[model samples]
Target chain A: MSVINDLLGGFATALSLANLMYALIGCVLGTAIGVLPGIGPVAGVALLIPVTLNLEPTSAIIMLAAIFYGTQYGGTITSVLLNTPGESASAITTIDGYAMTKKGRAGAALTIAAYGSFVGGTAATVGLVVAAKPLGSLGLAVGPPEFFSMMVLGLALLVCLAGDSMTKALISGVIGLMIAMVGIDPVEGAPRFTFGNEFLLDGVSFVAVIVGLFGLSEILNTGTERPGKVETPGFRALLPNRTEFRRSNPAVARGTVVGFLLGLIPGMTGSVSALLSYGAEKRFSKYRDELGSGAIEGVAGPESANNAHANGALVPLFTLGIPASPTIAVLMGAFLQQGLTPGPSLFVDHSELAWGIIASLFIGNVILVILNVPLVRVWTSILSIPPAVLTALILVFMVVGSYTINFAAFDVFVMTLFGLVGLGLRKLDIPLAPLVLTLVLGPLMESKLRESLEISQGDFSIFASRPICVVLLLIALVIAATPLLRPRRRKTRSKENQHEAA
Target chain B: MHEQNQAAPPDRPSPPAGPGPTGPPGPAASSALAPLIGQAVLALVAAYVVFTSFGLGLWSHIGPGPGFFPLVLGVAMLLLALSWFVQERRRTATPAAAPAQGAATATEVPEVPVIPGIPSTPAAGTGDGSGGRGHVLAVVGSLIVLGLLIDLLGFQLTMFAFLLFHLKRQNAVRWITAVIISAVGSVGTFVLFGAGLGVQLPAAGIPFLANLGL
Candidate 1:
């Protein structure tokens, strides 16, 4: 009853006219962004941070959160119509989704995806509402030493699962930490790496760096390519048969469970959930044989899982102050920019704002279904716009966005440098997720480590002496040493994977 | 599964695969030089940080000083660079020690995107893997030029040229189309953001241009 009452109060705040309008705008723009060829949710969300700087913190966060989940559904449009994923999470959907389009059931596939997303996203929001207070309570019990160790664990998980090479991922993570190390030190207020530059005083701007890495690099990568062909699914084609909906219902349920569970882990992103869902459908779905042949279950399950993962990711950012994925890491940056610290403190200190943001997510999910299902043709047409035109406009926005950060030419240059760095990293097959995660975590991790040391009177054993800290660090150590310990096992597994593919 | 690449069959024209995640990092041994260059840069950066941290003071009475963490990070980076150098030399020394098993399999299946929104692979395809460098270089060079010229010629003028480069030079659209698109992108955004939204933008650094309302 107390939870329901709190939620009802949240409804009161979220239902205000201005807040609702921001949510709507967020959903609309997010859909367009997801439909864009080169940009994905990370760049899309980061680009909007500068735009949101003018709004109140509550309204800013509400709009950005709406955009985050909205892209999940929007990405489905590209998958079904063009056989291209708007984002990586939707990549698996292209297999069955494009097949459905070939069979003249593109509309049915998209409708099911939207319905699955609405169900999964709404269910996850309910989970968030139910789980927020307790998780936050548990988080409050952790001290600085534990917090420091936990962040290390978070980085380890990120690098371990992020890409092909953990070394490159770790290197990226170190670079991010070094980036954060610029500017005034939190404790002593002495500058560490400013090199006497005024702009470096605040550390490298997060928005500029990401906009460079994600947006600019994307344009440079895909700028010259032509847009692919997409067949528009007419309105009459949208109605899924009774059988189609009924068959997909169970897959949606299973996907929600899988996605929500995986999303709880610090480094597991929505694409991982979507992939596992795809794998699960291959193994456990009743219509497994039809998975790659335009079966509705293939479209519904992974789409649901990805959407569920997007919402479920907010749980950790809210409760434990850890970002679950790269996109969520940018969102966490928004929270920090709003002058609010996430974690247990957010719940206690800003209950109204916290609950309001959660409530608005429910409203946003409803808005996304409406935008994605009946109006999906609008998005397909977006794919028709000349790639040259879109790329040019995006670059313009990128420059303007970076410039507004502090009204400086310096940040724009920083963005350009990172764009080159991003290109180099991408070409090298180094994962960007670890860099993004550590960039968000670096300052906070540093503060906690310093505080823990202060409490221990500068004793290094403070980390090893505390039971929770020791346990967390041990987990991190094991993960970090896996490459050294299990090289033979890794090679064997790859061999097996090759054999299976053959 | 092999299904990853099958979705985009060869018959269809697709977005440039943007240097799809280096599969076996390509066949050329010349590519191995990249790691050496990376190590040299990292080693130099690490050395600078260690040297700078000594001046910043590593310890304070209460706890670690501002430099303490940077010092640690510097040493960590040096260690990782050394490790990479060692690994690469060993692999080069014995080319046949390990077969290209991972590379062979990599071509069969693309890197699964573990993170949503990120491709893990930057470009899905690299169209012809040709003629893209010039356009990319143009963007980089233009951005730097914009940084230098934004204050001189102002936001409107530099943005106009930047957009024009993408539209006219790289993309090779007609002059009218390029002019119109670049105009709308530059002047229109300048008005919406600078005038309407009241976000500050550079007007001009020179007294003459500022007087002319650039």
Candidate 2:
């Protein structure tokens, strides 16, 4: 009852004209960028963070969160219409989505995707409201040792799940941590890696690094690529037919449940969840035989899963201050920039803001469905703009956005340096998510470790002594060792079974 | 079996097949060398980090100093890089067997199985490799110019020049289109961010542009 009343109060705050306007703007802008190939929500949010510098914290966060989910909705348009995923998470949709377009059912495929996204997003938001409070309360009882161990678990999960190569991910993560340590040490105020520069005192700007890596690197890579021919099919009907709706109903339900559960796990992002859902649907759907040949369920399931996974990602950020994905990691940077720390205390200290943002997510979903369904034609036109113009505009925005961080040209130079580095990393197939995640969490881990050591008089056993710390460390160990152990175990089992059969 | 059939179809355009931007796909030989070079760079960086940490004092009377964390990280990074180097060398040594098998099957299928969620296609016009490098240099060079000249020419002029150059050099836009885009993008962003959003942009530094305010 209290949760319901608080949500109602949140609605009152979110309904204000100012907040509503920001939500609308975020939704529109998020869709615009999300429609563009090669630019995902991470760069979209990073580019807009400077623009929100003047807004109040609550409104700023509400707008940013809206953009996050709005991009998920927008990604589907390109996947279905052009067979090109607007974001990586939308990749699964291209199989059946593009097939549907080929069969003259693009409108139906898109409409089902929008509806499924709404259902998934709304359900996950409800789960976040129900789960966040209990999780936050649990976090409030954790000490520094436990917190450090938790961060270790988070990093382990990221490296383990990041890509095919664990070593590359670890190297990327270490580089990010090293970058985080470049400025002055938090405890002793001693400079570590600044190399005698004044800007080194404040550390590398998160905005500068992100915009360079995601925004600028993307432009450089895409600028030389040949543009594909995008065919904009005329819309016949906006809603799915009755048969099509019924076929996708169960897939939407299953995707919502699967995506929400997977999303709660640290380091499991929307891309992973959507991929898993697509795999599950391929096995379980009644139309499985036709899945890759324009089945509506294929479009419905992965689209819902991606959106639900995005909403599910917010739970950890709100409760324990741990970001579950790269987008959330960048959002955490935004929180820190606003002079607010995310964690259990945020709920108690700024409950209104927390609840208001949650409430705005609910409103944001309705706006996304309406915008994606009715206004999708407008978004498709964005695809027709010359890639040259788009690339140039993105570069200009990257420069302006990084410059606004400190009004320093040096930051732009730093951004350019990282842009080249990012280009190199991308070519090598190194996942950027783990790097971004560790960069945000590295300082927190360091500070917590120091505090734990201080409490135990410099004894290393303090990390193992606490019950929560022990469990978290154990989890991290198991996560890291699982990949190494699996192949060996399978080989051993196969040999023993062959011996028994012989 | 059905799932495998759906997931592993050879004719389907793999997730990475499209020419949308994310860099040109380099040849397999170059890709093999990339990780080797990357690990080497990582090793060097680790060494520098370890060398620098000694000045910050690893341990203090209270607990650990600022250097303690970075030192630990530096050592771990070094070990990881070493392992990566060893693994890459082993893989490279065994590549002959795989290439023989791959070449045997090469004519049966033209497209490789796409790795889900990773772009696989090489950029158009980059198959020869030289064009791709030139594109990269052009973009990076423009960024350098923009960074160096932003303060001297002011935000609008610097952006205008950067856009115009990139559009002409890399994108091959017509002269008129490039000019129109450069003007609209630079001037429009200036008004939107400066006047509307209240960001303080650098004023024109050139004497002639400054005097033109009259």
Candidate 3:
């Protein structure tokens, strides 16, 4: 009953003319950027942060959150029509979505994806409303020791899930932590790694690094690759047939559950959830044998999962101030930039803003389904623009975005430097997600650890003394050990098989 | 090691024999060399951090000081680097019997391509090849030039020139198309960000443009 009243209040704020306008604008821009290759949600959000600076906080966040999920809908169009995933989460959709397109069911695939996304996103929003207050209240009980341990666990999960190589992921994470330590020490006033440079005083701007790493570096990478031609498919009858609908309904339901559940776990997000859902469907579905060959369930399951995962990810951000993915990390930065710290106090201190954003998500998801279903042709046309012209336009935007942050050329230089570093890392196949996530979490972890030690009089046992802290630390330890043990266990099993054969 | 795997298609079977001299180095050699270089550099950086942290004082009366955390981070980094070094060495020493198994293992693990939102097909003709290297250098050089000249040449002229050069040289777009695109992109952004968003962009430093009222 309280949830209903709170949601009504939230609608009052979100349905206002200004917030709705921003939400619509975000949906349009997010779809536009998502349709383009090399510009994903992370870069799209980073590039738009500067544009949102002038708006009110609620409107700004409403638009930003809309963009984040809007990409999920937009990405599916490209995957179905172009066979190029607009983002990583949409990759699984391409295997069967594109197959459906090739078989002249592009319209059905696109329509089902949008519908699945709507279901997943709406369901997750409901989950968020029910789960957020309780989670935020739980966060209020977490002391510094528990917080520190939780952060460690978050980092561990991130490292475990990031890329193929745990070593590379750890290296990237450590490097991010090192970068975060560059500015003045939080406890003491001493500057750690500034090298006497004045620009380093405020530390490396997170937005600049993000734009460079995800945006500028991507442009450089695209420059090296030859562009592929895309054929725009006609949109006929934008509704799934009865048979397709029946087959898709169960997958969508399961994907929603899987996506929402995985989303609650810190560091697991759209890509992981989508892949896991696709794999699960492949293993268990009645259409399993036909999954990669234009099965509608293949398109339905992952699309739903990715959308649900996006909403699920917001749970940690709103309640505990922890970003579950790179996109959310940038969003968290935006929250901080807007003078809102996303934690337990956020619900009490800025209940209006919180509810406004949540309510806007519901409205935004509806807007996306309507917009994307009818405007599939418009988005497909966007892909017809020359890659060269698009690249130039993106560079201009990147430059302006960085410059507008402080109206300084120094930030542009920092952005350019990180761009080169990002290109190098991408070449080496190191995952950028962990780096960005850890960079955002590093300071929070440090401050919490410092406060915990102070409370315990420099005794290390405080972290182990608390039940939550102990459990969190144990989880972290298990996650850290899993990658190491798996190969050894496989080796032993293989050896035993050989012995039995002998 | 990661680089070599990224260079090849995920599902492509490894050759029975190692790569020849005319071809790029085999995965084993490249993997060993790259990690060796990366770990050595990381170790050196960690050592510097450790040395500086010691000077800053790792402990204080209240609790761990600023240096204490970095000190622990540095030591952990060094240990990780050392472990990576040992792993790469062992792999390189046993390459003859490992390449096929390595390929199988690589295929088993899902390699999410790095583009974040979009899962692109394996980039066409992109790797650590010289052509790719040249393209990267060209893009970086243009950005550096833009950063250096933005104030002096003014934002509009600098951006126009940078865009024109980047399109023509890096992307191989026709000169006419490049010119039109560059002009529109630079001027359009200036108006949107500078005028609409109220961001202050540098004005044209050229005397003729400044005296246009005449």
Q: Write one digit per residue (lDDT tens) for candidate 2, span A300-409.
A: 99999988988998998899998888888888999998888888988899999989999999999999988888777899888777666777778888888898899888
Q: Give the C-alpha lDDT of model 2.
A: 0.80
Query: How much is A313 displaced in model 2, in angstroms?
Result: 0.6
Model 1: per-residue lDDT, tens digit, B104-174?
Answer: 23113455678975555444324324326786788899899999999889998899988998777655578
Name every residue pair that clashes in candidate 3.
A86-B118, A87-B117, A87-B118, A88-B117, B1-B31
Clashes of 2: 1
| After superposition, candidate 2 runs with Cα above 4 Å error | A486-502, B1-32, B96-120, B123-131, B170-172, B211-214
**TM-scores for the candidates:** 0.91, 0.91, 0.92
Model 1 residue A491 distance off true place after TM-score fit, in angstroms: 6.1
Order the candidate numbers by DockQ, best to worst.
Answer: 3, 1, 2
Show what share of the native A-B interface contacts model 3 retains. 0.30
All-Cα superposition RMSD per candidate: 5.6, 5.7, 4.3
For model 3, the superposed segments whose C-alpha errors exceed 4 Å read A224-227, A500-502, B1-32, B96-131, B170-172, B204-214
The sequence of per-residue lDDT tens digits that candidate 1 reaches over residues A121-193 is: 8898898998998999989988999888888987888777665456667788888888889999989999888
For residue B159, what is the lDDT in candidate 2? Answer: 87
Candidate 3's residue-wise lDDT over A305-390, tens digit each? 99999999899888988888878888998898898899888889999999989999999999999999888988888877766667
